[model samples]
Target: MSTVNDTKFSFAVFFLTGIPGQKDVHVWISIPFCLMYLISIVGNSVIVFIIKTDPSLHEPMYIFLSILAVTNLSLSISTIPIILGIYLFNSREISLDTCLAQLFSIHFLQCTESSVLLLMAFDRFIVIHDPLRYASVVTLPRIAKMGLVCVLRAVAVVVPLLFLLKRFQYGRANVLSHSCCLHQDVMKMVCSDITVNNIYGLFVKILTMGLDSLLIFLSYVMILKTVMSITSHTESIKAQNTCVSHLFAVIVFYTPEISLSVLHRFGKGSFPLIQILLGYITLLVSPVLNPIVYSMKSKHLHANIIKAFFK
Candidate 1:
């Protein structure tokens, strides 16, 4: 048990845990993780490259997609080093500073991704609800400003978490539940009073992800209403189809997050392996799947992907 002094400074070195009870198979497990990381990097990079190089793909939707791709790439890059180190090299020890940095990066990127998704939802709604005015409403400059706001908002919300955490002394066991450091996982290791941290953390989550989700839901409802009011059934279906890829992206991003929250709150006695696996899904799956979802669903993007790769 490592201890910190009254200065609120921690010299503690935290050990990241891999899948519980799977030490012997960690090497084998790393293979699939490596593949997923590779796919995430390559897929998101291709998406970004296609969007950047093609003049036709410079619209608000594709610009937003490029931002999402960059976010996914950063998210994956932040976690891959620690995860692969743990599974492949059995390098599980992470310094307190490094752990806090990882925690900040993961949460910040998650919030930014949520904001981007909400922006995408808004984009789709505008396109469907008022196609003629979308050009004036959702211009490239406005999209750039929105993207900047998302990043700055995430920083403002998540940076305080570091200060809140820094005031604590993590004298208890420093073994984190997941290979990557999460705010909640790190919070659990603190031996000091955590009431403020808990309250503030919850507040940030609600303000950022929770609020974004509600607005996204409302946007979709309005979209549905507009689509229904359209007299042509084919047009309604076409409008609905525009959202399928984004819907998949939302599901891919949020399902694991929701599951992990439920697991942490109610499934305390659940299997440790299950907990770790869910954590991996939360961190890894969105980056791995988002590009594939868009590539398969968007005809323009799909064609470009083929041209870039196959031709």
Candidate 2:
């Protein structure tokens, strides 16, 4: 019953939506969600643990992988609580401040993940393009610095979004389209003109993920060229094989993300259920798959995991 003019940011509460038209089966809907979170948490945790404890795995590549595992773990942790709360307890109401915090954390981690993938691509490129200098050029200290820059870049870009959303006046119709808060979902609920918000959101996406995607593509192109120039066919195949896991990681992370972003911007008339599903996939799939893909592809990691757990 509150008018747009009467609503204050401090007092505003947003309702989150879960599994459209399945309010009766919210508890049932949570089973798969819970499983995905469990896999993401335990899988990524083991990856990080192995990397941290093993001295032989302290190279730049494994260190980067550990950073990525930590990022995936953080991303899953940020959203799982509220999502499970909504499904199990029907606790869908989220305060404006909490919603904004969730939004920031999710997007920041996303940007950080994109950065990590870019770093991985660069790592692969160095390993393939210049194997001897790989250790010299991509040292652990440099990798640590790169990881710090990724976090800083994410912070710089995502923090401004909090301020941008704060200036908007929201109305009583505060139901979010997803079980967790997203910038686009929250921006849609604002009663004020969101042109600036939309523009800035797009700008951030372009500057971070968009740019990262382009760089990753360029890195791969160079990697392929380097591989082809190798006169030894077996060596070329071997070098190309090293990149397969990182390539799969890129596809798993970016495909749903790009689909969701395009759907939000251009698929206004598209089914709401499709958007909701893509939203969940964008948030959950990479976290669940990355650890599996890397473990299966990297013999060293696979052996370590088996030796640690099975032995």
Candidate 3:
């Protein structure tokens, strides 16, 4: 552990980071993450461009898709650049301020993306349950308002949580086990009592992750009920298909996130290598999976993707 210098410029935070066992292992890990990062950038960039350029896709769902694409782009960029930097250079040292900044941005963007997904759920519910009045209800002004609210919600919730975390006094150890600065890894550097931080972390998970997921589940429940009441078999089938892609994307997003959180809390120090490996894998998989999942499983999105590519 390094000491925090009283003089600002003299301060250098040493991170506790893991190195791949062999050169071969480093290459293997680096290769996949590199590919995922590339594909995610291209896929998400195309989605944003297509949505912006296509007049027909000016609807609520496409707008949300565009939002998700941009979020995914930023989220993955924030993570992978640092991850790749570590892998290539084996640099583990990070300043306290830099680590904290990374922690805040990582959580801020990731949680913002999750909030957007919740809004997408509501958008789907409106489209399916009341298609007749969908246009009237989801007017342009209303869409803008909803978008603003979602942004504010994510910032409002995550900003305070992160600011509160900065209150914890930290030791000089800045090395992280994983590529990027995960909250848990950074929190472990705290020299002060972390009771307040832990409590607040719990509150954030309950409100942002737990509560958001619960609401998503409820939205789908209501969506299912509404679908069932309709006697038209084809309509129900279409509704089911429309939801399947989103369901896959949601599962891909939340399952690994929750698993990583649980593993950090309970499985610390038992298998650090396994944990870091899984952390890197999850970070690579979650954002990249969305575009692939949507393209493969969603006919409408696939068509749009094809048209965009060809054009």
Residue range 202-266, candidate 1, lDDT tens digits: 78878988899899999999998999899998998999999999988988888788778777656
TM-score of each: 0.95, 0.96, 0.90
When superposed on Cα atoms, how far off is each prediction in RMSD?
2.2, 1.9, 2.8
Q: Which ten residues in a row have the lowest lDDT in candidate 3?
A: 1-10
Residue-level lDDT of model 3, residues 1-311, one tens digit each, is 23343432245475635555664566566677789899999888877887788787788887887888888888888888777776676666777777767777778777877887888888889889999999898887887887788778767866775666566555444456776777777777666677777777778777887888999999999999999998999999998877786777778778878877778888866777778777765666767877777667756667877986787
Q: What is the Cα-based lDDT of residue 311 in candidate 3?
A: 73
Off by over 4 Å in 3: 1-12, 16-20
What local lDDT score does residue 66 receive in model 3, on the 0 to 100 scale?
83
Clash pairs, candidate 1, are none
lDDT for each residue of candidate 2 in 172-207, tens digit (9 for 90 to 100): 548888889999888888877889988999999899
TM-score of model 1 (CA atoms): 0.95
Candidate 3 clashes between residue pairs 3 or more apart in a chain or in different chains: 14-174, 14-175, 15-174, 15-175, 16-175, 16-176
